[model samples]
Target: MHLIIPNWAGVPANIGALATLRSGGVSQGPYDDGNGGGGLNIGAHVEDAPQAVVLNRALLGVLLPASPLWLTQVHGHHVVDAGEVDNVPGAVEADAAIATRPGVVCAIQTADCLPVLFADVNGRVVGAAHAGWRGLQGGVLQNTVARMRASGAGPIVAWLGAAIGPGKFEVGADVLQAFTDTAQAPEAAVGASAEMTPAARMAQTQACFTPIAQRPSKYLADIYQLARIALGQAGVTQIYGGGLCTVTDINCYSYRRDRVTGRMASLIWLK
Candidate 1:
C-alpha cells in the first residue's frame, strides 16, 4: 500500500516512520474505492470484511521489520508498551503505543482524529498517539511522553499526522470548555494579570478554538495546535507534520467527510 514517509529531519537512521494513505490494497465496497479497486482499508473494527482487513495488513507487513502493535482506540488516554504486545495484533485496547525494543512498531489508526508520532533525538524510543478531542483534552499526549520518559527516552520530537483541519472540525460549547477548563494560563499571562481568574485562564486557551461566524456556541478547533500545546507542556519542542488535512484532502480517509470511510495508520519503530 502507498505510505507517506514522515517529513521529520535529524532523527536517527534507526527510527522508521510513515503514515498510510487510502490507496493500494485489495478491498471492495465501502472498504475499497466502491468500484472494485485497491483501497488499503486496515481497520478491522470498522465493519470492513475480515479477509480484506487481513490482506491489507499483510500488504503493510511486507514493508516493515515486524508486525505493528495495532491499538483498538476508544479515544481514551491509554498508552501501552509495544514490546509487550508483539503477538496480540489488534487486540490491545489503547489510544497510544510506545516502543523501545527494536522492530516493535507502535501504530495508531485514525480517520479524522489526529495521529501523533514521537521519537527521541537518539532514537532510543518511539511512540504513537491517537489524539481525538476527548483524548487530547484528557492528556493522551502527556501520557505518551511520560511513558517514553519512564522507559529511558530523551528529549522527544513529535510528528503530527493527517487529521481533520480546523476549518472542517466544528464542535459545540462543551468541546471548547473541555479544553479551556483544564488549561492553565501561561505563567507570563498570570504574572501580567497579577491574579488571573478562571475566566482569564479560559480566555487564554481560546487561541486554538475559533468561533464560526453567526454560529453561536459553535467553534472550529485546531487539533494540530492543541497537540502542539500538549506536547510543549510535556517539554517536547521539536514538532512537525501538521499541514495535511484528512477532511479536505481526498488522499487520506476522513470520517467527518464520509462516515463509512477507511482508516489510515501512523506508525514508528526503531531498527
Candidate 2:
C-alpha cells in the first residue's frame, strides 16, 4: 500500500504517523486502486461492499499499533479522546480525536476533506482532525489543540494531509462569509489592531479566499492557509505538509472528482 510518512521535525522518536493512499487492498468498482487493482477502502460508511471494506481494514490493521479510533465525522467541531473510545468505529460522533496514551491511534478518514495530525514536541499527546470547511469554521482544530493542552501537552506541531486544493474547492458567498467571520475573533484576540474595525478584520480574512473572475460570488478557498490561520490562533506554529492536493492527485481519492470514491486515512500514534 502507498503511504505518506510525514516528513516533520521535532516530533519525539516514539510517535508514528502516516497517511494512506487509495491502493493495495480488495475494494472494487468505484473504490478500485489507482491502477484498477484492489483498493484500500477504509470507510465502511462509503457504500463499498462490506466484506471488501472489512478486508481493507484488516490490511490496514497490519500497519497500526492498535485499532485506530475512527469516528463518525459530522463536519462539526466535536473532539473526542481516542483513549476513551471503546465502541464501534462509527459510534462516536466527532470530527477530531486526541490520545495521550500509548498504543491509542488517532485516525481521520477523508476523501476531499483536510486531515490534520498533531503532536506535541514532548510527545505526551497526539491528535488527528478531519477539517472539512464546516468543521474548520466551527473550531475543530482549535478544540483539538485545547484538548491536547488540557492533557498536559506542551508546544504542538501539525502535519497537514491531503485535501481538495484551492484551485478545485470553489465556494459560494455563504461559505466565504463563514470563514471570514470565524477568522475575525482570533485575529482580534491576537492583538491584531485596536484601530481595525470589524470590516477591516473581515477584509484581512479575504486573503485566504480568492474570488473567481469568471464566476460571480464564487471563490477558491485555500484549505491549507485557512488551517494555518486557525492553528496559529491556537498557538501551533510548527506546521508542515500542506502541498498535496487530492483532487488532482490520482494516488489519493477525491469525492468531488468521483462522487462514489473510496476514502483515504491519516493516522497518528505514540509507541
Candidate 3:
C-alpha cells in the first residue's frame, strides 16, 4: 500500500498536507517487508533494523518538500518554533508541534497518538502537533498555535489526523478529571465537565486546561473532542480531519493496540 492519508480533502491553496500510512515500506515480520506482509516500521527505536528505517525515510524523502521534523515524543506538551528549531530533531525537544517559515515542513510521528496539522487559510505558516491524552490536556495545540500566531498566522484551520478512537480508549477518573479547568478554557465539547470534587476542579485550573472526556464516573473521551475544545480556545475553528481511527485501521499504526508498533508521520508545508 502507498503511505497516503487523505484525512484532509485537499491541501489548501497556501498549504500542503500528507500523512503516512503504516504499509508499503521496509522491515520484516511484525514490520512487514514489501513481500505482502506486515511492513513499514518507521520508528528508529522500535527494535527494527536501523538500515531499514533509513531506507523507509529515504522513500518518504522522495515525496516531501524538505526533511520532516521528527520528534522524540514523550506524551507531553511542548511546541517548538521551527525557525528557532536546532535544524535537527534532537535539538528541538517537544512532544507535539513544529512551525516553519515557508518551505519548512512541520512533521509529527505517531502510532496512535493523534497527529494534527495546522495552517492558515493563506498559508503564511504551517505546523504539526502530537496530541496524545497528556499532550492534549497539557495544551500542546494551544501552545503551537500561539507560536504560529507570533509569525502572523492563525485563528487558523487545522487537520486532525488518525489516532486511537474513543471506543478503544478506556480511561480512569484522573483522565476524566483532567478537563475540569477547561470550563475556564474558551470552550468544552459536551461532557467536558461533569461532577468532580472541588479540589479536583482547583487542580485543573492551576495546572493546564487539560480536557479529557468521561462517560459516567469516567468519561469515554473522544480525543477529537478534546482537540476541538483546546484548539477552539486558541481561536482555531476551521478544523478538518479527525475521522480515521488508528487502532481499528490496519493501514495506520496503533500504540495502544500494540505498544511495539510502527509509526506514521503527519506533515504540512506551504506550497
Best-performing candidate as measured by TM-score: 2
Q: Model 2 lDDT vs. the true structure?
A: 0.89
Worst 10 residues of 1 by lDDT: 185-194
The CA root-mean-square deviation of candidate 1, after full C-alpha superposition on the true structure, stands at 3.1
lDDT of 2 at 223: 93
Q: List CA RMSD, all candidates.
A: 3.1, 1.9, 5.5
Cα deviation of 139, candidate 3, in Å: 0.7
Q: Relative to the true structure, how large is the alpha-carbon lDDT of every model? A: 0.85, 0.89, 0.71
Instruction: For residue 28, give model 1's deviation from the true position in Å.
Output: 1.6
TM-score of each: 0.92, 0.95, 0.82
| Clash statistics: count for each candidate | 0, 0, 9
Best by lDDT: 2
TM-score comparison, 1 vs 3, better candidate: 1
lDDT of 2 by residue, 1-271 (tens): 8999998989999899999999889999789986879899999888999999989888998998888987999999999898886857788999999998899998999999999999999989999999999998888998999999999999998999999998999899999888777656644454223466766667766887889998899999999988887787687889999979899998898999999999999999999
Q: Candidate 1, which segments miss by more than 4 Å at Cα?
A: 33-36, 185-201
lDDT of 3 by residue, 1-271 (tens): 4655544433467577788887778777566633456466778878788888888888888877778777777788877766566667545678755555666777788887888888776567778888988898887888888888888874577888888887777666677666665444433332333444455544544343233454445445578877876776677767788868888887777778767677778878776
